[model samples]
Target: MTRRPSPPQSTLPSDPILALRANELLARGRQLESQGKIADAARVSAELVNVAPDLAEAHQFMGSMAMRTGAADIAAMSFERALQLKPRSADLHIALAQALLALQRPADAARILDKGRTLHPNDAGIFRELGQAQLDLGQPDAALKSFSRATKLVPNDLYSRHMASALATTGAPNPGYVAELFDSYAGTFDAHLTGKLEYRVPQALAAALAEHGPVAGPTLDVGCGTGLVATTLPETLRPIDGIDISEKMIAKAQERGVYRHLRTGDAHAVLADEPDFAGPYGLIVAADVFIYIGDIGDLFASLAARLAPGGILAFSIEFNEAQGIAIRSSGRFSHSPAYIHGLAAANDLSILAEVSHPIRLEREIPIPGRLFLLRRG
Candidate 1:
């Protein structure tokens, strides 16, 4: 998540007249932001930056406004200028790191945060952000150390504590963690998954669906990221409803115009609330979603109750040889076939088909996966 900037701290110009104007503009910008006039606030900040180019606070405020407006590139540039004007400010370094992370440049963010940590070793904020950057770069061990240090520095910080625990234990991460992770990832999810990771589960699930006869009722796509399932499936499954945790991902999915409905929330809670979700779906597809869930027994139960008679529930899992589910350091879960079989039996759902494939490439190594089609009795 992008961190919002603190209130403006103006460095008045030397000239009394210019200083008076700068102070007025600065106050106006703060007032506009408080009143939710983000565009107006951005204009005010831009004007301030123009009038006092040497004022680091003006540039910082400009960057914060750009961040609020979703102009991450502009925010990064503005933050860089702020840092150049005030090299000693830890706040500037932190803001710049946030902009870089928003732009999906984790390496650069990590570098900046590393420097920030050097400059302010005791700052918990720097350690927390540095941990996130490390996690993004696939360095869980390093991230765990960073988060642990943050926890030590600020024991009351729940975010840091939760992150440290998630990395250290074999449990599902907090919903907020998943939401933030995907929100940051939503921009490049498609290309990173399909191109770099060789993700083909969506298309493979589509082909598997073809073997079944016509879908008997409305369909649902649980945890549908970017509408990949809707896009890959045959047009026969139009008007699919979707639920996901990330709003940014939901927005991208909405842009595809394939889904009839979409909402942002935990899939488990939505699936369990049948009256609200009104499922009884003909088909429910969850592509590459189980990796985030450590124990999916409750989810399976919910899905079973929502399926229409003879309805097909299709999903994918990172496969493992162990008897149950296991979460790795990479913050993804892998399930053994035995665990899935037990879920089907407990839910009274019959396994219709199972296909094993490479779900994606992690560090050039294939990650094994299993796609299953289960039918409600």
Candidate 2:
């Protein structure tokens, strides 16, 4: 007769020795994870689960590992199991919500975050996560309220406070906020922007440049998110330099191998970094970049100083033509033609061409905007 092995335990033990051993195993697993030994950590966690199946920490470790591997569905299952074992764990709730969001279940993530908020009313992190979920779910009004409540809970938290205030007022978005937004968004930026948002600014800019017949010079693309602008350029066009605030965005653009160089920093600060390049670029582009910045005088002055004489500066802006500058509810800045052209004139740049170029789709209607090409004196 063959001997049969015992089935694995389905429940944790209450015995002193078993409990102590389980704790030791869990601690070892966590230590391995802390040391960046993910495989070792996973093996240890599996051992812990085999010995003590109801251990939430083991499940949580597996959940985190799954998340890091981009197995969001597995992560969600592990987190849900952990939640069943430890229903009151706020951190588990957050992890589960994050997995759900990554899985494209923003509404479900919002629900999980809401449950977390009910348990921990003062947890600003939960509120922030909830707000993000709401925003992704197209409930911007609800997101604004959640963000406001988060800032109220933690007054000194610059990110939540900035987002809350920026959502409520007409002001330029903080550069850090813009960078942080895009850093998290980099994974889906190209697909979401081009396919869903109907963004054609980069292609439009290329076509506009092409009208000038094989335009070529030392060029710079400000806020070159994923370097989509490079696709529209003529073969004769130079490998343009690029700058962006988000390191993730810069990395994505680098993978495209289009730019002469890519830099991660504030676009305003990059404007001042003369050592990063030769004297001045003959063509400077701000394709959809100025939407994050309201006041243009300072930027125009910097562009004028950095553009060689007779060099070109091309850019785009969302315009309603009602005000010199307006901050939309979406937290983007829009400017009127008067505002941009005034700055160009004040900076001694001549507007060579201005065309109505609407790119983004809102409720199936194109958003009003303009693309302008200017020349330095």
Residue 356 CA displacement from its true place in model 2, Å: 1.1
Q: How far in Å is the alpha carbon of 366 misplaced in model 2?
A: 2.3
The worst-scoring run of ten residues by lDDT in candidate 1 lies at: 322-331
lDDT of each: 0.84, 0.79
TM-score, candidate number 1: 0.60
lDDT of 1 by residue, 247-335 (tens): 99999999998888788888888766646567778888888777886778787788788888999899999998864865553557789
Q: List runs of model 1 lying over 4 Å from the truth.
A: 1-150, 153-170, 212-214, 273-276
**How many backbone clashes can be found in candidate 1?**
0
Q: Please write out the lDDT profile of model 2 over residues 175-215, one tens digit for every residue.
A: 56788888999999999899877999988887787775345
